[model samples]
Target: MEEWTVKVNHCAVKKEKPQTDQLEFGRIFTDHMFVMDYSEPLGWHDARIVPYQPLTIDPSAMIFHYGQSVFEGLKAYQTPEGTIQLFRPEKNLQRLNRSNDRLCIPAIDEAFILEALKQLIYLDKEWIPSAEGTSLYIRPFIISTEPYIGVAPSHQYKFVIILSPVGAYYKEGINPVKIAVENHYVRAVKGGTGEAKTGGNYASSLKAQETCSQKGFAQVLWLDGVEKKYIEEVGSMNVFFKINGKVYTPMLNGSILEGVTRNSVIQLLKHWNIPVIEEKLSMEKLYQAYLDGELEEAFGTGTAAVISPIGQLSWEDKDLMINNGTTGELAKSLYTTLTNIQYGKEADPFHWVEKVSEAYAVK
Candidate 1:
């Protein structure tokens, strides 16, 4: 494999950084971004780190018409020693390729992209917040840029990475939140785009999420699309339930996304000698477990929230209060441990943290 070089273009003007205490998730962006263009013969080329600005694409671009796009999310944390690091970034890049394969988009060189991401983060390292629950949120995405509006995959595409200084994903932070079981709209079915981290999967979930939000719920617990009886996920996050001292999460099954955070949580549980099972968990069975006083805890895992405890689950006019509407001991421990590892405050037994050196940003 040939090595790829990224060119850098500094921005003429800089934007004022937001106060770390008042930072909100995805609301503020950094000064620079990384972009690369792809075409047939040259493949992915002309990789560059440029000033953050609006993209100028043709109105008839295929991404606007057919939605041939894929994205991945991760974060960069500032440690107490002022070093910048990433958590399981390789997993995100691998998943991005999987999404590209599923969407019929061209595959990117994961190693090269990872280097480019490190350089980009190094350039904007100042934007990484050092607050208790703050970090620089990273969004990497690819979009079809071909001008043709037909229903086929595009020959041209663009890969971009942008950074955002973010605080907690939820206003409730690590506290427990209310969740509603979605019974109407389905997010995805087996043999669909659910397994891929694509925009269409999230676009299809807005209706159910909106309804639940209006009903005073923090998020909606999505059910399986075909049967509408099995638990799938919780509002953009992978869910896990603790019933009778065992942790259970819905199996991938070609529809549920393979979340990086979810995998880490399972690994952590196993490391602690906890039994974690992945299988098709039906809503009926879970509710029965709750009735039997076996559902001890419930939570959702994702890159943004990390671990959001599901305090109350409302299903079919029946509210299931989990752990007396408080964060469970295991959930709290997992959150603290994961965040501590990311921030370099604890020993990283899994070697999941990848440090970004200042030399990467040197011209």
Candidate 2:
């Protein structure tokens, strides 16, 4: 990773930072952003961190028509000691490259990009809210910039990273949420770009998500595209269930995202000697577990919420209540532990938290 050039924002007027209580998700952005361009032969160059401004892209850009875009989400935390840190950010960047590969976009230099991200975070460290359950959300995205687009890959691309100070993902705090099982609509297929962190996959899920919202559900529980019986994941996160003292999550079957929070929960469960398995989990089996009085808990893990307990799951007008429609013991434990580690309230036994200064400096 090399040094990144920084251009200070000299605008006389600046947007006021929102109050900690008023910090909502993705609504407010920081003052600076990182950007880089890519083209054939020259590769990725002109790396710089400039003031946050609107982008001017041609209307005929390939990204506008072909939907060739990939993005990754992560957060920077302001510890109680006033230091900024990142949790498993390298994993997000690695997944970004994977998405790039799947979307036919150019792969990024993971280490260099990581360093650039750290520098950008450090530059806008004040944008990281100090309130509990709040942090600076980092969105790194790549869009195809080629104006003439047909069906093939584009030769030009732009990668940009922006920061947003976000409050809690759920307005009600970490309370359990109701989810509606999506039986008619499928989010992804096995042989498609399901596993990639791209916009199209999420754009395809909006209709189903909107339908669930009208039904008074927080999110949609997606089933497999082929069978529709096998569980895949929930909207924007990975799903997990506990039955008979054992935790189970749907395996990565080339159709579900490999979430960093999901992996961390699995590792944490195993470290505590809890039985955890990654396999093909079916909704029918989960419903059967509920019938047998063994369905103990259910939750969704992601960067946004970290751990969102699922209190009720509705399928075909039948609802299955888990943990008496409250946050489960395991879910609470996982959320507390993960947030503790993120905020530097507890020692990171897994060595996942990376301080900004060390991450920016070379060995």
Candidate 3:
């Protein structure tokens, strides 16, 4: 592993930490963050741990114009024994590299970055919240920093990791939420940046999300960008449907994000001997399942929500009430099992959690 410099924030007055109960998603940040620079000749270098502060970027940076950036989200949970651990963090880093490949950005050393992240988390270990439904949110991102206006990949870039103590992604927590099916605005098309964890895919969805929010929907369920028939994702999470004791999620068709939680959910289902299928699921078919009373459950899975039940899905101005507008038994079980594994409350049969040792921090 590479040796990175560490600069502790020894300011006279430290920033006040928010109460775990009052913590909002991605709002309150820790005292320190991890940063690394990348240039054409030097590659990724100047890795350091410094105090949390804003970056001084050039006004003409490529990221500001061409939108060449990629990011990954994960969480660090504090166990009951006061040990900090991460849930499938390596998967997130691997996905980040996949996103980098799509964005024409230089690949990062995932092992080294994970080590640097562990060191950063260990340095700010106090920020890890122990409250139920709360964990330290980790945002690892890379941005093009070369100050150029040409429509091409930048030569300079910055990779940063910041931590935030968050309660729940949605204000409803694990409760069911109403979703509006997006028919007008398309999130991404096949052979686009949908599969990659990039910002442009999200930025394009905000307008539709905002439109649905005003209609009292928590989020918008995006359909396929080309034919607009098959389901792609729900808001920032991958969605799944349960019909007649079988689980189904949209297959990765180059337009859907392969979520870590989604994969875990499928694995857990298979572990329990439940039939789970990933295929092209259309809204009409799902509605028919609901009409036939076979739609047992619906939910969205992501690092933030873990498992968010879909109480109602509005499509074509008609509402499809799922599970009587309540959380399903399977959804609840998945949430409990995943959260327990993350917090070390249950035995991790899959060995997904990685503990962060104090030795990672630089003295």
lDDT of 3 by residue, 22-127 (tens): 8988888989888899997999888888888999999999999999999999999998999999999999999999999999999999898888899899988888
Clashing pairs in 3: none
Which sections of candidate 2 miss by over 4 Å?
1-13, 170-172, 358-363
Q: How many clashing residue pairs are found in candidate 2?
A: 0
1 versus 3: better TM-score goes to = 1
Residues 1-363 of candidate 2 have per-residue lDDT tens digits of: 355453444335557888989998998998888889999898988887877999899998999999999999999999988989899999999999999999989999898888788888887777899988999999999999998868889999999999999997766668999999998889999999899999999999999999989989999999999989998998899999999999999999999999999999999999989999999998889999999999999999999999999999998879999899999999999999999999999989999999997444322
Off by over 4 Å in 3: 1-12, 169-173
Better of 1 and 2 by TM-score: 1
The lDDT of model 3 is: 0.92
Which candidate would rank higher by TM-score, 2 or 3? 3
Candidates in order, TM-scores: namely 0.98, 0.96, 0.97
Q: Global lDDT of each model?
A: 0.94, 0.91, 0.92
Between prediction 1 and prediction 2, the one with superior lDDT is 1
lDDT score, candidate 2: 0.91
lDDT of 1 by residue, 1-363 (tens): 266789999889889999866898887899999999999898999999999999999999999989899999999999999999999999999999999999999999999999999999998888998878889999999999999988998999999999999986655557999999999999999989999999999899998888988889989999998999999999999999999989999998988999999999999999999999999999999999999999999999999999999999999989999999999999999999999999999999999999999779748
For model 1, give the 10-residue run with minimal summed lDDT: 167-176
